[model samples]
Target: MSTDNSEHMRTIDRWLAGEVVNNTIGIKVVGGPFDGRTKIVLLGEDGRPPAVIRASGGPAGPSRHAYEAVRSTDVRAGWIYTYTGPEPATES
Candidate 1:
């Protein structure tokens, strides 16, 4: 598959336009379907990355998977996360 991260870049652009500042961080996924994939996420006001990150394989219904932040030695490039599993069912 193509390794284009333009979508992630667009997210960062949007954040910049909104004056979000320098809270963007890189997240590396480990274990699961999206293993080895990297994503860009915005850090919270407290300078802490998100606890969980969600993504989909295509333009489908709900997200295909979720990743939980396990640890991070460096917020810029060492944020390590693991795939939790498929998205939980939601009430209709």
Candidate 2:
């Protein structure tokens, strides 16, 4: 498989594993913005509240916009689709 595919699989795995902890529970970046290149991050320990897990096109790039967007959305009622892949997912 391609690296992108691998990363995507990893993302899914992380999500299912509950390794990701974010205030934006329902808010998921549909297709990882930077393709499979997008990074997955987790904050806090097992039960603590998760902070920001920012993904970007370029490594070391800022995630202010993503943070704002996620915060703006209703994590309980709405979700945010990030444009980070070669092509965005159709079924998000």
Strongest candidate by TM-score = 1
TM-score of 1: 0.60
Best by lDDT: 1
Model 2 stretches astray by more than 4 angstroms: 21-92
Cα lDDT of model 1 overall?
A: 0.68
Query: How far in Å is the alpha carbon of 79 misplaced in model 1?
Result: 2.1
lDDT per residue for candidate 2 within 17-88, as digits (tens), equals 434435212334443433333233333354323334444445535332243223324333232445532323
In candidate 2 the C-alpha lDDT for residue 80 amounts to: 40
